[model samples]
Target: MTPALLKVQGLRVAFGDKEVVHGIDFDIAPGEKLALVGESGSGKTVTALSLLRLVQNADISGTARFEHDKAGAAARDLLSLPERTLRGIRGKEIAMIFQEPMTALNALYAVGDQIAEVLELHQGLSAQAAHEAAVQLLADTGIPEPARRARAFPHQLSGGQRQRAMIAMALACKPRLLLADEPTTALDVTVRGQILDLLADLQRQHGMAVLLITHDLNLVRRFADRVAVMENGHLVEHGPVATVFGAPRHPYTRRLIDSRPTRDVAPVPVDPAALPVVAASGLRVIYPVPRPGIKGWFTKGEFVAVQGADFRIAPGQTLGVVGESGSGKSTLALAALGLLKHQGQLDVAGRQWAAGGASDRGLRRLMQVVFQDPFSSLSPRMTVEQIVGEGLTVHAPELDVRARRARSLAALADVGLTEDQFPALLERYPHEFSGGQRQRLAIARALIVEPKLLVLDEPTSALDVTIQKQVLGLLQRLQRERGLSYLLITHDVEVIRAMAHQVIVMKDGAILESGPVGRVLDAPVHPYTQKLVAAAAT
Candidate 1:
């Protein structure tokens, strides 16, 4: 092991009169990879933010002594450093890679300009040199066509691309210690692996230490040398990754490690002879691409999103679509919902949507969708009652106000929301509830319309592991009770194992493999499925 690079001792952070991060201690040795693992609201992010005194308007009392790489140079306390001096060390010595790249990167400037700005400020490189270095950094991060991409704005690039640009900026000056806070949380499984691999490659090349903060235990197992678990502001466990994961000393640590998705009960068997609630065959979706200048006027090319896909979801069954970011899982969901124009046959509950509104009105009522992020899926301005009851107006417009109110209350109660438990439930807003509660509200809003098929696009991906299990259980129970079918689109193999009865592996806008959940996941023959399963197991 190398010598210590940074040591955090008696680290405490308080907001107002309440202490969120109790006194804790940890250390990162030279070129070491240390992971801080904990669930959301467990103070993992806060702890990482406090290392550089980045948290605003908070009481901080700690000694985060950072050993200068220079031989015999005295160690300085980062926590107690004066603002003027700390600014010099920020990007020049130690850099941070934020979680959400879209929010972190500048919207006004090109990606290359953003990276160049970092180099210009920290390394004092001229504009031309900094821009050249930024392009080289983007290429280093595995972003193909770096020259063109470096000129692209954050919104113009894909999610993975934006994240790579963020990494490029972080590594522009080659700092000694890198702080990554949930760096891969927003990425797909394959993309997450790519980012981690890139980090490992750069870490080896630069010989920099990494302090990773994430809740995913699997990531810690694969990437970290040592692990530390925090719960309710207290550091409960700290040891080598293998040692801590193999034998967690604290109950909280054990629970966090044990929270992986597991199949507790046998999945309910779907009758193969029964009619499918949702059916699609040779479904194809394509978007018209605009050509440059005068060529665009002559012809418009097409980009295929979902190509030649076929699947069926039986009544009271879950059909999981597993794939990476560009795999067209969500495209298939949109096609199934009649939200996009497609070239193949797709029927829902014996009927398909058509051009005529009068003809498609009945088919539209049979299917609904629950989106990925509950916060964005739900309307912030509306009250709980309004958000849930809005569906009733469209589906059962003949019903009077009194009957609609009654049905809305019943639907809310169905999803575990009751005025008895939550007083003023009808008046409460979505922001007032937790992530799990907001998802329940989303489910209620979808269920209030009594749709036979629910298109769930990464429904639990935004939640913590335990919360995901609870939500999946709730969805399963609802399916059993109401004979509802789900088209579950997600990248999580564990989630597919726990929820789906039938599974299909999608790649490059096509179905690579399709079979029973156990067969496809446990005994996958396709190389893509094999890779997904292997990654999940790790």
Candidate 2:
């Protein structure tokens, strides 16, 4: 058997007095794909970082030995390597593709320049040679118009494009190992498939070992040869991917797999007698593009984010817009909530709302939105009470300060948070809360308005399976009790099966299929819809 390329034993990482990762062990064979699966705060990222000695201002203890393929010499302890020696190994021997490509790439530099930097630093390539190599790498990663895109800044490219650029940069130096963290998290299903296929092809061609960090069990099952499950800072199980997923030993692992939304589980029936909350028709949003000419002119592109889309939700039903990223799922929600410019007819109960109008009191009172990233949506400087009560103060100024405070606390309780927890949390900022708690707080903020319709945009994407299940249950219970309507936008097919009464499959800003959840999900007609379902199932 070929010897392992990297082996880690008893890895522990700590931040000050708190130890986050409690002794984990794993190994990566040459050209093998290994996955670390866990929920947020489970130390998956920390473990990957520990491999590179990148954990800043933290105490890390472990033995990470690297054995070169060509030489049968003694294995080198990576942790004991001097700074200069480790630097030589970092990008030259091992490279990492970070989760958030936007933040990972330098905003100020062109994408080509970033890739060029890696090539120049490691390979000592000249400027022109590096630039040419950068374009070639981009092309190799399946990015179209590589030359033009290479000159574009990170912010100018789409999410998938940015991810491809990151991959290009990482592979430019021809490293022996690749560490990828949620590499396809925000991508659409088609792009995700392409990225995965690309990774597999590259791994085979280059014979490089891969250490993948992700929460998507389906992806792990499909791509990884070996799997390691982590929980509460410990590696609970590790084995072949099929063995671990097919016959999970740990309770946490079993729960994670079972928590995924599936067609077998029936959605709770919602009452139809509740008030008509939100209704929209023929919604279309077009963005202006700059014309390529000397004259200062802009041309309107017919990129309809929500093209002639129509839907209605009673106060108690969840109309799930199921699609990949950039499929106009979020665009539909934004249009209905008057958050973006659109040509559409929208009515909240009896009141008509002007598309993208700012002075629609009825729209504001009738509908509220829960954004995907609670950390960015919630003000980091504001306390929880202030964040939750801000809408109350704006809409119902008649309510005094004390009344608002009481209302905020009540709202917190409605979402399973308590006032006792509030004393510290209320005084603290959003960064202080865990991802699940932050989402709960976001839900509380939306619930405080007591609106008839709530637009939830991928609210559970960042959460663990167990936390997602609880949140979905909470939404269902709230809908039954308070008669709330939900316009749920998500890419998780299981979420649609479990929570949606109706499902609309979208692609390229158009609806490809729409029907009752059971009919569309179980018997999808459109090829795109079928592809999405198939991709999700694996």
Candidate 3:
């Protein structure tokens, strides 16, 4: 057997008085891929961070021995190393690729400058040499226009391109080990596959070990050689990927493997004359961009986000929009919500979005939106009662304080949040609840006004497998009970398969195909749709 490149034993992490990661043991051979799998708050990320001593104010106790490849270099315990020695080894021997590049990367510096900084610090290269190497690194990561992109800031690049640049920086020094935390969770399906492939290729070329921390089981299955299951800070199981996934011994592991989204949505309405909650024809949304060169000095140029699109959501059916990033699915959804001005007709509840009219205020009550991230969407300052009851104030101003409080309680109850499960549920803030519970609160807020339609924007993407399953089940039950129409916008094909009756495929701001979900996904007519399906399968 090959020698272990990294070995960890009896690892524990604690913050203040609360312990997050219990004692755990694992090892990674040279060029091996190890996946630490768990849901939210399961302590998977904490374990990885502890290995690098990156967690601030964290009391970490462990024996993490890293065997360097340099001649006569002794094996060192990472936890006990001196700060100066560790700094020398951080970017040169071991590097990390964070989850969100937008937050992890410095906005002030250009991407190429960031990568060159790493080379200058660890590799002892001159500024001119480092800059050229940075561009080459970006090229190695499969980025187009590498020289030009190196000068762009983090916010200027697309999501996938930003991730590629982050990978470029992490691998600039050719580290022997890489720590990737949820690297592809924020990416679309096609882009996620591309990143995985890129990592595999680079790992093979450099013979480096990878410790991937994520909650995505599908990603683990596709990329990891060995799998370790973590539940509530405890290491439950560890084995080869085939053995673990084929016959998971622990119940938590088994539950995760079985948590793929299942179909349980309400049937489509049979009546042909049923009025649509939202109807759009020739909807076009354009944004003014600064024209390049001297033309920018004269006037602005138009960029069409959504071009001449047509779709409808019936009284009790779901219309799922599937596409890659920058494909304009969210823009289409915004137009339907009357949040953007369009060149075509968009009717919500039998009325158009007029300019500050009384009818528009009433029309807002007919539809409500649930955003992608509940933590950011829900106001942190507001209590549970205030967050859920705020909608009632606008739609039902006739109700007094006592009546509003009563309605809020009922809404919370309808979404499976009660005083029994959560003590002082009304008074507690958003941070007090877990991710799943926070999403349930978001759903409750949307359903309080008794709207005819719900615009669900990537509702379950931020959740893990089992939690995602539970949330989808909740949405299905609510839709069945309330007969709610949904304009679902997501890049997840399996989610579209399970929840949508009708599906529309979009690519580069245009609808490529539209039909029943089963027909379109299983037997796609368009090449782009087929490409999407194939990528998801892998």
Candidate 4:
């Protein structure tokens, strides 16, 4: 067997008096792929960060033995390395690809310049050589028009492109080991697969070990040679991926494996007398964009986000919009919610959206939107009572203050959040709750008004698998109990399969396919839809 490239023993991490990570042991062989799997707050990321001494003010005590690349050099403990020596080892010997490239990359500099800076720092290459090398690295990562994209800033590139750029930067030094922290967590299914393939190819080319930190078990199963399970800083289990996933001894591992979204949605209502809660025909949302070259000064160019989308959500039914990022799924949801200006017929609760204008509180009362990131969506300044009952203040002003407070309490209870589970739940602020709790608060806020139609835009994307399962189950239960109509928008195919009665596949702002979820997903006619399904399967 090849010698272990990285060996961690008796690792412990603590902040002040609180120790998060207990003593844990693990090893990564050269060219091996090791996945550290756990939910949020499980301390997987802290363990990885501690390896490189990147965690600020963290009291990390461990023996992380990293063998030097130079022959005959002594093995060094990475945890005890001097700052200057660690700096030399940081990028040149061990590189990291952070979770969100948007936040990880410097916003002020061009992406190419960022990568070039790494090359110049470690490789000591000339300015022009590093710049050229940066473009080549981007090209190697499969970014289109690499030269042009290199000159673009972080925000200028799409989510996938930005991630690819991060990968390019991480691999520029050909490190012996890579620390990938949730590398594909924010990506769409197809793009996630692309990144995985790119990483695999690059890993093979570099013959480097990878320590993948993620809560996504599917990704771990697909990509990892060995898997280590973490639970609140303890290494619960560790073994080859096949053996561990095939038959797990640990209860936590079993629970995680079984946490995939299950199909438990309410049966579709059948009544000729019933009308769709939300309906749209030829829905088109167009935006004005600046034209390139001299034409931009005089007139703007038209960009159609939702192109003639035709869909309807009958009572107690879910119409799922599935696609990649920027595929117009969210735009369609926005148009349905009366939040975006759109052409063509859109009706909510038997009333046309444009006829009453977007400001019609009555129409707005019939529909509510739950955004993607609950942490950002729920205001930090507002208490739970204020956040949940704010909708009632606008839509149900006739009700007294006491009535509004009662309604907010009821809403929170309905979403499985109560004073029993969380004492003083109503008085607590958003930042006080966990990510899953914050999402529940968002749901409660959307539900306080009792909207007939709920537009959920990637509601559970930010959560761990177990938490995601809990949130999805909550939505399913709410739909069943209230007979609500949902315009669900998401990139998660499994979610669409589990929750949607009817599904629509979109690409480039056009609906490629629409039908029963079974048909669209299992036997997709369009090539693009097929590609999406295949990517999800892999």
C-alpha local distance difference test of each model? 0.89, 0.86, 0.92, 0.93
> Which regions of candidate 3 deviate over 4 angstroms?
none
TM per model?
0.95, 0.94, 0.98, 0.98
Q: What order do you get sorting by lDDT, best first?
A: 4, 3, 1, 2
For model 1, give the 10-residue run with minimal summed lDDT. 261-270
lDDT tens readout by residue for model 1, 283-336: 999999998899999999899999989888877788999999889999999889
> On residues 419-446, what C-alpha lDDT tens digit does candidate 3 reach at each position?
9999888999999999989999999999
Best by lDDT: 4
Expressed as tens digits, the lDDT of each residue in 1-538 for candidate 4 is: 7778898999999999999999999999999999999999999999999999999999999799999888988889999999999999988889999999999999999999999999999999999999999999999999999999999999999999999999999999999999999999999999999999999999999899999999999899899999999998999999999999999999999999999999998678567677789878999999999999998999999999999999888899999999999999998987887778999988887887664543588889889999999998988899999999999888888999899989999999999998998888889999998999999999999999989989999999999999999999999999999998888999999999999999999998999999999999999999999999999998
lDDT of 1: 0.89
Report clash pairs, candidate 4.
none
Query: Which of the two candidates, 2 or 4, achieves a greater lDDT against the reference?
Result: 4
How much lDDT does candidate 2 score?
0.86
Candidate 1 vs. truth: CA RMSD? 2.0
lDDT-better candidate, 1 vs 3: 3
RMSD of each: 2.0, 2.4, 1.1, 1.3
